[model samples]
Structures are given as structure tokens and as C-alpha cells.
Target: MNDDSRKAGGADQDPFFMRDPEKLAANLARTIEEAGKAAGFWSRARESGMVSDSSFDPFADMLRVFSALGQYWFSEPSRSFEAQTRLFTAYMGVWMRSMQELTGQAEPDKPEAKRPDKRFHDPEWVQNPFFSSLRQIYEVTARWAEELVERADTLDDLTRLKARFYVRQIIDAMAPTNFVVTNPAVLRETLKSNGDNLVRGMQMFAEDLREGGGIPRLRQSDLGAFEVGENLATTPGKVVARNDLAEIIQYAPSTGKVLKRPLLIVPPWINKFYILDLNEKRSFIRWAVSQGHTVFVISWANPDERHRDKDWDAYIGEGIEFALDTIKARTGEDEVNAIGYCVGGTLLSAALALMAETGDQRIASATLLTTQVDFADAGDLKVFIDEEQLQALEEAMERKGYLEGGRIAMAFNMLRARDLIWPYVVNNYMRGEPPLPFDMLYWNSDSTNLAAANHSYYLRNCYLENNLARGRAELRGRKLRLSSVKIPIFNLATADDHIAPALSVYNGSRLFGGPVEFVLSGSGHIAGVVNPPAQRKYRYWIGEVHEEGFERWLETAEETEGSWWPHWQQWIEAQGNETVAARSFGPDEEALDDAPGKYVRKRV
Candidate 1:
């Protein structure tokens, strides 16, 4: 606990360290050397375009942001002076507080004044004077840097977003908790284990680097704890059909009789479809079946170079349309209810427009879960959609034919790096502990690749150009318009969603020509939509859709406790409540595979 004790390698406190410091030191040195070699290999691979996507240098953008900030501040001498004085004043306050603490003259910080940070939850961070001061300094510096960006009024909206985002990244990366010596939890573990934790951690670091094929894929959950069909995606079903882009999985009937209009689920291709079917307890597909709805899900293929030419047209034609045709063939049904999650909903909306143009009316109703048809109010994800980044991304996809799943996974993880990236970094690499087995995290880790043409078109039309909402989007040489799609829509948006902001989803709801019932749910992108009624977690809002604005709608909306599953089921049944005998896959339509088809099983 003292300087001398620390300098003596905490040997007096650690029996293992006191007994054999030399052996521990030797092992630490060797492991660190091996880790260095692995890091060197990763660096080389990134340089050679094996790990990284393309020449999209994020650092260049960061520099541009700072340059704008510098120019704005320096434009006026008073402004520059004020900025410096403000930062220094904050530092002075920190120093004064630390002095007071050391002299035992400090009053306890008010609970309201004490900003709760999960990273500094360890008692030592508050109890130890040095760590307490260190935390205050980090907080001060981070706030100052963020304020600099916020005050840079000269920067454009996109540039400001990028600056804020990049600054947060830097501040988070520099946090004391990330480092071993500064992190009391890791330090205690290290001293207790006599440096053995470091050795094991470095070994894992090297192994993960190797597994990633030059990129360090941090394990967010115990990889061996769950498998696709065994425990995770265990819903009973049969793969009724397969094509170039997807497999249509029709789940077995849980009830003797099912709804007349079957339900089809289209999940985002960015990740596997099993998020909705993680287990019996949380499986939406199973829940739907139990509620007397015959469910069919589209399991998109994990693409490769061969799929590089596959564009939006290919996805709509082979994925959505193909599933539609298969669903009709399997069940002697002419119409069906459909649900699309995230980007899949975007694609489905486009397909519906195309179907409208061509007078195809098989889809009776649609449920969009955390989906964004209009990207104007899209959140932090918009930071990655500018022209420069798109070109760089396109170049990378051009070389690889398909964008790697790991790259997509990394981008989403980076959006919430504090929760997703750094905690795993400190636990896996510093404390030397494997992540707990979380089915949601496991599903997140299991990402899927995107074809070059598909990803490019999506970025350009949806995020970059905002063409989908603008009615300028085209699919397969036909102009697609959301207004043309007249089917009733159940639009669900999560209050805390980062990928698809609720406001954006609300804005998108107005674009539909038919009656749109916009529902707001608690939690985020994944949890909000996958919520089953039995859990009794999170709430949902329902009321008349206010076309004016989301705030106006919320003002009149009635909030309900528990999941929105029952509400959704009621809506779907209201459309066509007829009862039919539970149907099985026809003998003509032979089973391609078991439920959670082979396509979902493919890993990048």
C-alpha cells in the first residue's frame, strides 16, 4: 500500500511473490515478448490489407477535427485564452481537492455530485487518495476535451459528430482503469497471483490474435460454452427451402391449430438470425409458435467473394421474395404476416415498395422492429457514412469482394466501446479472466459478411444519400417508394437504441402509405425487440400515431408494463384471425436441414 512496498514488488503482502519473484519475473518477461511478437504480426497484417478494411484512415479525420477546433479557437485571442484558462482552472480545482483529501480537511462528496462511473466502481478508486485524484484528473481532462468539440461551432454537423466521437474514444482509451498499474482490481489480482495472471493473459492475447488471423478478436463470452443448435438457437424447425442468399426455416407447430396467416421473420444480415431464438426461455420464434402463429424465418447466407456482385436486387429477389415463395409453397397459404428486424426491415420495406409497383400483394402486414427507413435523424452510426469513409470502405470491399464480418462487428462494438470493448479488454487482457457465457453477446460475436455491392448500395442509398425516405431509392431498375406500399405496418422503436434512433423510426413511420401504428419500447436495439411477455421486463408505449412529431406522440402515448409481444400478436391476428390446422412441410418441399439452418451456422 506504500511506495516502498510497491517498489519491493508487494512481496511482503504477496506470499507467492515473496517466495519466487525471480521465476515470476522471468515468466512475465517471456510472455510479454511473445505478445510483442503477436502484436508485430498483427501490425504487418493490417499494413498488408489483411486485417484492416482499406485506406480509410480514421486518424486523418481526427486530425481534421482538431485542426478545425484549433482554427476556431485561434481565430480570436480571447477565445484561445479562455479555453486554456478554463482547462487550467479545472486542473487547479482537482489539485485543491486532492490537497484537502491528503490533509483530512475534505468533506465527503455529495452523492448527487459524485458522477457514477462504472469503470471506477472499485472501492480503492475512492478510498485511495492517489487513485481518487487520478480519477478526478481523467474526468476533468475528458470533460475539457469534449467541451472543446462542443464549442467548435465552425465545424459542420457531421464533422462535429466525428470530433465528439473520436474525442470520447481517445479519452476512454486513456482511462486509468484500462492500465494494470492504475487499475487496483487488476493490480490486486496480479500481486496475488505473483504475475501468473499476466502470463496467462499474454498467452490468451497471442492466441486470440492468431485466431483472428491478424486482428485481435476479443472474446466477449466463453466460446466453448454454447453452440448454434445445441443450446443457443434451439427452436424446433425445418429448413424448407434454400437459395443463393438465404434459407427459409419453418418452425414446427407448437399448437394443434395455428393462425391462418403464417408469420415470416426477416433478421438483419449484419448478424445471425439466432438472436431471436437464443433459447427456449427467450426464443421469440418459439413464443410466436406457442401463441398459435406458424413462424418462418429467413436465415441469410454468410456471403463470400462469389457474392460480391450480389446487390440489393439480389437480396430482395433471392432473400425476401424467395422466402415469400417458399412460405406459400410450404403452407397452402396465399397471404402472410411479416416481421423484419433492423436492416432487414429496411430491405423488406424496399421490397414491399417494389412489390407494390408490380402489383404483388402476398404480404398482408409488416412489423418493423428497431428499423430505420428514414436515416435523416439516424444517431451516432451516421458518423461512419460520409463520402471519404464510404470510398475507403468500398475500396476495401473491392479488394476482398465481401466485407468481413469481424469488421462489421468491430464497428458496432466501437459505437459503445466503454461497455463493449474496454471492460472486456481489462478483464480478458489484464485480469486474465474469460468472459461470462452470455447468449446475447455470443450472438453479437457471431457476425456475418456483406457482399461488396450490397453494402455499398445500402450505405449510399440509406445512410449517405437518405434516398429511401426521400422516395428516390431504386431497386432492380425500378423506382421504389415507401408510399406505394399500402400494407398496414406495426413500427416498433426502442427508446435507447443507438443503431436506429426512436425519432428516426418515428419519422420513418410517416412515410408509409397505409395505417402505421408506431410503438416505442424500453431498452435497446436487441433487447427491446426480442422481449418475450413472460420476462415482465421493460415497458412499451402505444397510442394514436401523431404525424407531427415523436415528442407529440409520446405526450399522448399510454405506457404499458411488460413486453410488446402480446400487443403485436393481437394486431397481427386482428388482420386475419381465421384458424387453420397446424401445417407441416409438404412432402414435395423436402426439408433442406433442421431449424437454424446451415446458413446461420456459417462463421466468418
Candidate 2:
């Protein structure tokens, strides 16, 4: 495994490597050797309050404990734990009651039993109380262990962080679903496939060890089916303009006549821009085009070591400004409605603020989606954003020039261990089943790097300092206030976004200095925003952004069924004025390649 991958928690070693008898024997020997060293370290640390020999200090010990507690609580490890705990606790109680019923020793009448977590609501899990009780007992024990770790007063933050991650991983791996001995599905599949699943899984493990630094996220079959322009970002368009930082994609008009003010989408450069143009049905770019709006999506260059020196200001000048210039020149429209997602919105907002200060009026209106301008409560992601972590990250970035996209993916997967981590562990490594070829997952697995300077400046200024919200941020040699962005703005926040919580997004809306329409949509970060009107799956709510709190707004607001895309389009239509002559991406403004462009294809 590469040194970089080892630094990323060493998933390449395969947390479940012991499943093979030979590997288990080898691991057992290694564990014995490592355990002795660990015991020595623990004994030294416990007695002396230092890993190296030193006199122990009670005050120092207390401080270490406090720091650890801060890291644990801040990381939001229990965000989903509570739900799982409740489900298991409830399931155990239900089984107890059901047993009493079966014995004809039941008490008064009550409702039927149900699993706490819907994913584990396997009918078979409930049909047999013995198995159900087993799971519940394991879950209860795991929760107790988590509580014990959280309450530990001796461990430092780094120690606790490692402990918590390992504990959760150990517990998650021990779950019945992970092994044929415990899991019915695995047992059945094993009998049917004659242990061939294990063979494939081992092969996958070997291949992942060979390629992606030992961590295999999805089955190769899942990846084999999709490509960038052919599958995702498939919407027909031309790379009308190209520069060092970004490629401007002016999509083909899906309407007879398009709106006068074209829309230029500024997506987070930390990722490829095609997230807006994922596919035909879900692609926001195609949707905008069909809405009779001239859509232009910026495809950011996938940065390498070459882009290590490219800072945040470079993105503003070359990324946003460069695209803005192209949109104006092509459409002959002086002002264009701009939409920014994630960090892109943060930059666009800064740009608008700078422009407002400098008397530049290139933007007609603005829409910020699932993005944050305020860093105070940037959600569980903040757990890894504190001073020590940032400094360590900076050191790593300095060595690499840019932070690998895989590293970022690991952090996010950690945030939602159950949803993002363990299921894939089972599917790709245990069951040997290929993951579904979902479009969003494809985009998710396909990640892009953050340049060292770009990321460090952002981490220090925006996340660490919280300077942007304080109006202390400087851009293009000018001090700027974010609130100076007085353009009419529409903001969308997904209810379950872990990266940028709905409330955080709401707080950013308060920073805007114009008419604000804040809509709270259902689902999570990416899925919530990508929702098309056709899904008709999740609901959204829009209440007046009053002095009332976000919780108060939720309590009082009425939810409207279906996607917020229509509502957003309505707002844009009103702000963009009337429709004009249709214009397909005029022949590539200095064409480099096609719509998906060279930048989208660049991978680490």
C-alpha cells in the first residue's frame, strides 16, 4: 500500500482481513506483536500521562480528557447512533413481549413489534426472536461500549478518535450480516454459489490492494458500466470556452426561445462540475435547458500537483470571473443569473460582494444550493476542521501538493458509517455482489482533488477563522463583506445534509441582503438537490425567513409535495425577465474538446 493510503487510516489492510484462515493466522501473530507495543504505550501513558517516560500531572491529564471529549462530541459520532440504539432497544423489548405472548404469559394488549431501523426491518430478523434478540444484544453492547468510550476521562483526543473509529469498525464488522455463520443471506448465497462469492471477494481485495491503495469502495462491475459523457454529464453541449482553471459548457437549448439572461452554474471546484449535469433525467443542466433557460455549466479542471499553488483568489479570477466573461460575451447579455453549489456558492457570494464593492454588475440574480456562507455550524464536517486537524491536514497537503479525492471520501464515509461504509463492506467485500450502478454513486466515487494552497487558504480563512461571515474576508486585494451581496437570492437546503446541515444553510440565507426564498427539501446533501420533478418522492417546505428559529419554522411551515426545482425555476423566471431568441452553445469559443472536456477525465 502507498504511504498516502496508510495515512488515510489504512483501509487497504482490510479491516476484515481475518476472515481467511491463513490470513487470520498471520494477523494473529502480528496482533500479538502489535499488542505488546500497544500495552507498553498504554502503560506508559497511563502512569506518566505521556507516551514517553515522564512524571504524571493530574492537571495535564484533565486537559487531555477535556480535549478528547471535545473531539468526540464535535465529530457527531452519535448523530446516527441514537436512531440505531433506539431501534435495537425497541426490537429487544418487542422480542421480550413476543416471547411472553408465545408462552401464553402476555400482559395487556399492545401494538405489534417493529425494528428500530428500517434497513434492518428484515422480516426474517423479526420472525425469529432468538436471532432478533441476538442482534439487539450485540447492538446494546456496542452502544454501551460507545458510551464508555465517550465517558473515558484519561484518553487524549487523538487516542479517543482512533479508539472510537476502531470500536465502531469492530462492532460493525461483528454484525451478523457480515458473516455466513451469522447472516442467513450470506449462508444462502454461499450454499448457492458454493463459496465462489468468497473467491471473488478475495480477488477484489487483491485488486483493490493493487490499485486504489487497498480500499475497494465498489465492485468493478458497478464501475464498468458508466463513463463521463456517455453516461453522466451526457447532456449534449459544447465546451464553448476553455482556460487553465475551467471549461464553459453551453448546453443545447431544449426550448424554442431561451431566456435573455443565461444561467452560469458555478460548482465547487473541489469536485468536477458535471454534478449539475449528471445525466439526462437528473441533470440540473438539462432541466434548466428544458425550462427555456440558456444553461452554462463550468467544468473545473481536476487539479494535480501542477495546481498546488492555485489559491482561492485564483479560482475567483480564473474560474468564476472567466466563466462570467464568457457568458456575457456569448449571450450579449450584460447580466446573467448565477447558481453556485457547495463551495462554489461561497466563492460566488464572495465574488458578488467584491463586485458590489467595486461597482461591477455582471450578475443579474443568484441562487445558492446546499451551500454554506456561515461556518459556525457547518455540521458534523466541522469535527475534522479544528486547529490541530487542519494543521495536520496542511502538512499532508504540503507533501502531496493537493489533497487526494479519496481522502476526502474517507472522511465523509466516516461521518455516516452505517449508510456509506459498512453496507459497501458487505456488498463489495463479503457478499461479492456488485453495487447498483446508481448515477449519484458513480459521481460520488469519481472524486477530484483540492490544491494545497486553495484548500489551505479555504480551511484557514473560511472554516477555521469563520472570517467570511464576519465580513473580514479579502478578495482580489479588496476587503469584502458577504452581506454586500444585495441581489435577489433563492437558497435551497436539504433537511438531512450532514456536510452542510439545513440550519447552516439557513444561517447563510440570513447573510444575504435581498429578498430571500429559503426552501427546506427532504432527503440529503446530493440526492435532495438533484431531485427532479418526476421522482415525486420527497417533500419540501418554504416559510418566511423571519426572526423565528429554524426549528420554529419547521414546526409551523406546511410541506409541499414533490421537487423544489419547479419553485426554483419560478423564482428564476421572475428574476430573469422574459424569454428571448434561442442560442445553442455557439461553436466552441476556442474549442479545446467536447462538453465533458479533458478536465472531467483527469483522475488521480
Candidate 3:
């Protein structure tokens, strides 16, 4: 037949009989028929004792199919009701088998067997017929809905549809699945291993529910906790520290004499400064105190909205300047050794640079821990600091008068979304398991807000413009230049840090025009800095040439493992004045009272 005649005949044929239409209608009809058949089969199976009354309910299965179809239809432009219905049925079938196993029901094909391990016992909630049925129904319905959504061809449309939900699914799917097991037959073996894990997870959830807890509280494992030096708490040394917002805690050493040079610790306002004085065994502060160093940490005041107006200049003026002056006044010394951590480190660098520009030399030595003076290569976080994102974030902060800590945490988490966010999704939702409490997670959750002005300025200038590395950064109208501050510098960075990559930290040595000792610690950002010697999980690489780049120095430097704190101690001791004398910054200012300063205490 001619093409035109064939086309006319095709158009004239029954609409339902057309190729595409027929296929689609057939698929839909088949889905509805199968769904009805499934309902009947389940009902018969229940009556035939193939599935226990407690494990299977025909009504619940119907609800799941209805819910899945409803969701699928509601998704307008992208519809897959039949496909989703099939997925729903498949998921329900699997869940029914699982429920049967938990409810002491024996399948005709395979007999039920009891697990010998108490840890593998099914939870009471899982055994409860009502809860189990409801859970399976909901899970199957949700999974099917997700399957429908995931079938979309375009990410752009998916992003606009349910952006966060789709992002989470994408992240979960992409998360690391590889393990170090070498056996070729490990897949089947691992399934057996997973059976026990599933049971254990179920039991864990039941216990938590029984106790009215969502997650188990985590404790410092035996291997995680270590003691600090004995001298950490020996005496109420010349330095008396107080947290006005919290309580006053006195730290004294047994030394007959304090160091002639006073020490001032500048910790990032983001975290508590106790990391330096973590415990008796791993405490760097304790070790320094034993070595007769007159040390004092600037416990930042956790600020609230009341202190929203406080800018970077104010932090330098009232915070570091105040601490430095106080130390100078107390010790009767003109200069003090300053140590800064992370943001605190950057602030110290700025302060020193500003001081040097004005020819003020109160800072004798600057030791920066996991600190970044140049933000040119600031790692993964750079992605979120792009112009568009920064503008949106700035607008957000302007409305709130501060950058919310939760927002900042979210940004950080995005750098490793699969690791940080998706695992929780799989455990909490997919597996019906509760989250496990972790101290690090607790600390991470306890976040602090950043002042609106400071955050906005920091992003626009340092991260976006690369001002710090370019030497165009300014503090209070004064151009801040690291090279101008020719002071002895000690810069330390961790190898696996995501926030401040080692390469970025290493670039600091080149930025400074003075003698720089670049040390590479073995750990992530926080862990590396909080590392105490007792853990024995740290290593460091140090290079002698202060002017050379990190890569060049790495080629010549020796690699060594263990805490680098002792090495830092030796470096400080070598540069610090040997004489022991009480040097006070000023008369004990009763302005604030101890560990967590007021600024840190302010809620995000």
C-alpha cells in the first residue's frame, strides 16, 4: 500500500487498536488486573495459612497500591502509575516475607529457624502485627513513589519538582559502596552477615523506643579518651581564666617559675578552647605548663543577637587586643607568643599584619593551627561560596542579622553529602533503624552563628575575591598583608581536612615573608588540632625552608608518625625566653567569668 494510504488506514482504525495506544492501554489494563489478582491471591494465601494472620493483611496491601497510584498520578507531567504499582507490589511481597519471618510463622517452602545470637533477636515492635503491617505498607508505598520520580529523564525538571528530596536520592545512590574485602564469593557471605545486622538494628530500635529515646547516647570510647600531663592542674598559676557566661575554672601548674614570655591562645570562636587542655594525658596546654610556659587562652564570649553589631574589627580590637594587652600588663612583658586556631588563626594573622603595618610589635611569635591565612585554595567550601550562592546567603544573613550556624553546617555537610546525609537516610528511613549517637556528631550539631557583617564581608572579600592571598584584604581601612608581618611563623595543617585543604594551608608559608615552619599533621581538620599524644594516631611532616612551597619541601622532608604536639613544644621552647617569671597582661579584669566564653554560649 502507498504511504499516504497506509497512514489514512492507520488513523481510521480504532483508536485503542493503534500501536502505541494499544500498548499503553494493554499495560494499564494488565496493571489493574494484576493488582486485583494480587489482592485475591494474598487473601487466599492468608486463608490457606501460607501467611500468618498477624503478618499479612489484604486491606493494607490495597492501601499501599492506592497510595502509590495516587502519588504517581499527582506527579502530572511525569506519570507512571502502572510502573509504580508494580514496584509497590514487589516491595510489599518482600516485606511480607520479612514480617512472616519475625512473627514465628513457618513458610511451607522454608522452615523458620531461631538465631543463636541474642544480638540478632527481632525487636518487639517488629514482631507487633499492627506496627509491622503499617511500616511495610508505608515503606513499600514510599519506595514505589520514589521509583516513579527517579524514572524522570531530566535532572533539571527533577530539581524543580522536589529539589531537596531528589538531591537526597541522588546522593544516596552515589554513596560509596566499596569495601576492602578481597574474597570473590563475599557477596553471598555478606548477605548472611547483613541478616544479623538487620536483626540487631531492629532490636536496637526497639530498645531505644522503649526508653523513649530516638538514638543511643554515645560515650567516649576507651581508645578515644586519653589523659593530659600531670602538671595540667597542679596550681592556680599566674594565669586565671574565666568564662563570664559559664563558670570560672582555674588551671595551675607545679612549676617553680612561669616562663618569662607570656603565652596567649586564640582559639576559633566556633569551638571551645579546651581542646588545648583536653585531658591530663593529651593536653598540650598541660605539657607547656609543665615546661614552665606562662600560658593563657582567650576564651571567646559566645555572642548572641545582642552582639550582632560586633564586626571583624571589634573581634580584633576587643578580643585579641584585649587579651594581648591583659597578658602584657600581667607579665610586665612587652611581647607575647600568640597561637590561633582556624578562624582564630586567620584573625591573629590579620591582627599581626595590621600591627606590623602600624609598626606595633607586641606579638613575638605566631603559631597557627590548621589555620588559613590565604583563602585562594580553600577547598570544597569554595563551591558554595560562588557569587550567586554568596549573594543569596548574604541576603539570608541580612534578613536574620546573622548567618545561622545550621546553614553553615549544612554547607559543610554538602561537601560530603553521601557520607554525612545519606547514611542517616538509609538507616533511619530505609532500614527502619535509629541513628547512633556520636560525640563528633554531637559537637558538630552544637554549632555557633556568625555575625551578619563578618560573614558577609568574609565571603565577599576572602573567598570570592581571593583578597587575602592577593594581599588586597583590609581590616578597618588598613590593608592587611601577611608578607608585611615579618614575624616568626608556625603554620600547621592536617592532611585530610576538607574545610582548609593542606595545599591552601601550605600556601601560607609562601605568603609570609618571614621564617615559616610548615607542619603537616595526620588527621582531618578538627581531629588533627585536638590530637593528644596518647592516641598515637597522628603523624606530621615538617620542612626547614620557610620560603619554599609545600610540594618542593615534601620532596626533601622526613615523614614521621605520632602526635606533633611534642614537636611544637620543642619549637616553642627554642624560640621562647628560657627564664621563668610571672608576666601579667593586666590586673584580673572582672569583666567576664571560664571554659566556654559568652560568645560561644550564644544560641545559633
Quick one: RMSD of model 2?
10.5
Sorting all predicted structures by TM-score, with the top scorer first, yields 1, 2, 3
Please provide, for model 1 over 1-604, each residue's C-alpha lDDT reduced to its tens digit, 9 standing for 90 to 100. 5445655775556422345678768868977897897888788887876777347666776787788878999999999999999999999998998888777799623212556788888766776777888888888889999999898878888888888888888898999999988888888777677778887788788878877778778899998899999998898889888988889898988798999999999999888889999999999989999999999999999999999999999999999889889888777788999999999999999999999999999999999999999999898888788898889989988987998888778889988899999999988888878899998998889888899999999999999999999989987678889998889999999999989999999999999999998899999999998898889999999977765698999998999999999999889888889999998656566577888888888887
Task: Tell me the spans in candidate 1 whose CA falls farther than 4 Å from its real position.
Answer: 1-21, 43-49, 52-54, 108-115, 585-589
lDDT of 3 by residue, 162-207 (tens): 3334344453444222110211122223243433333433343343
- Estimate TM-scores for all models: 0.95, 0.79, 0.61
Best by lDDT: 1
- Output candidate 3 Cα RMSD: 18.4
Q: Lowest-scoring 10 consecutive residues by lDDT in candidate 1?
A: 107-116
Better of 1 and 2 by lDDT: 1
Candidate 2 ranges beyond 4 A from true positions: 1-115, 118-124, 127-130, 143-174, 191-194, 214-221, 585-590
lDDT of candidates 1 onward, in order: 0.87, 0.73, 0.59
Ranking by lDDT: 1, 2, 3
